[model samples]
Target: MKKNLFRSSSLILLVILMNGCIRGYTPDVVLKKDGQPCISIPADEDFFRRQKEFNILGLDIFQTGVGELWSRHYLDSKDHYYVKNQQCLYFNYKFQTNILYDISFFSTEKGDEENRKSTKKVWMRYMRIIKKSDGTLQLLLDKEARDYY
Candidate 1:
């Protein structure tokens, strides 16, 4: 009995020690001077070209994976975040009565106007994702979105 108890406890302690030594996954997040978490990737291309196809991918990513990252950061669901790829991305995902994701991918706010452009790089000021009545997903950037999903 004594031998069994000692062996079991030793094994448990060794497992615990090994687990602690393993590191947790840390996302590649850059902190702004104002303490905002942002993804530092290049935003050189257009917001939603190719008939709003890019917006659809972004929306799908947010729903599945990006949203998980946002939750892990403990950010407010209602509050939007930013990504600095020189273009500026003030983004947010809202899952209220209607799922809404508005990512200001081309413009910056009043405070960080000098860091980037205050006005939109493209004609469409905002990149919004929407679902069509046909049960298919689509992106609504502006008047042009009416033609696409």
Candidate 2:
């Protein structure tokens, strides 16, 4: 009975350890124009007006790729693992719009040599703010994206 219990515990521990390195999603932070929450990266009225001087703001494109240089150099190399150009996002936040912020997602790592390669899955976050009414800013996690908008 003791042996069986030890085996079960070991299995559970293994599962937990394996999942420890996995990357997850960032919750959405979106509010109506009525304004409930404040903005984290705040700007001024002139900042808003200038941003609207142009009808089309700008395009923010994010490209993610992975693989060793040598492996990717060849026509086909099965030795390496890769995740390339996984996602692309385009958005515009005009000054006239009532949106306080626009948020996107990305994944990254810090202080880990083993994670040097860009092969790991990541969620990149993009945020664009139109205006901020209140001086207070709060970080929130929700179904849309995770940020303080």
Candidate 3:
């Protein structure tokens, strides 16, 4: 009986540890126009630090660049994140009327300057903003489109 109890406790501990490793948060998405979805992702220190991990662990390719041209022009100067609220990263899609889309975010790192710029432009073409019924926006990676690219 003691052996069985020990096994059960070990199993429970394993499950707890596994659960703790799973990291992700539901982003608040909002639609500002007919086809434009704005995604608000956590930009806190913890979230920012986990970007590489998140990209490696998730299906979507996560990178930062300047937002859409129109949105970039209207970004809030007072906010640290700028282009949106504090402690948040704003992702907006441009040319909603057209079937094709272009997305952007500000790069937070500077290593490998030339390579980063080339890769940044390539990845931008794969991202798209999707709006949910609840008025929140989602950032999605178009794997099919990426494959073609």
Winning model by TM-score: 3
Q: Write the per-residue lDDT of candidate 3 for residues 42-136, one digit (tens) a residue.
A: 44523445443111111122222322243332223232232222222434324332122333233323232333322121112344554457966
In candidate 1, stretches whose alpha carbon ends up further than 4 angstroms from where it belongs are 1-42, 45-82, 86-90, 95-124, 146-149
**TM-score per candidate:** 0.23, 0.20, 0.27
lDDT of each: 0.31, 0.29, 0.35
Order of quality (lDDT): 3, 1, 2
Best by lDDT: 3
Report the error of model 1 at residue 74, Å: 17
| lDDT of candidate 1 at residue 46, scale 0 to 100 | 27
For candidate 1, list the clashing residue pairs, or say none.
138-149
Task: Report the C-alpha displacement of residue 149, candidate 2, in angstroms.
Answer: 20
Q: What is the lDDT of candidate 2?
A: 0.29
Clashing pairs in 3: 29-136, 29-137, 30-137, 65-105, 65-106, 66-105, 66-106
Q: Write the per-residue lDDT of candidate 1 for residues 26-99, one digit (tens) a residue.
A: 11223344433343233433264322111111211122112322222212334434443442233343322123
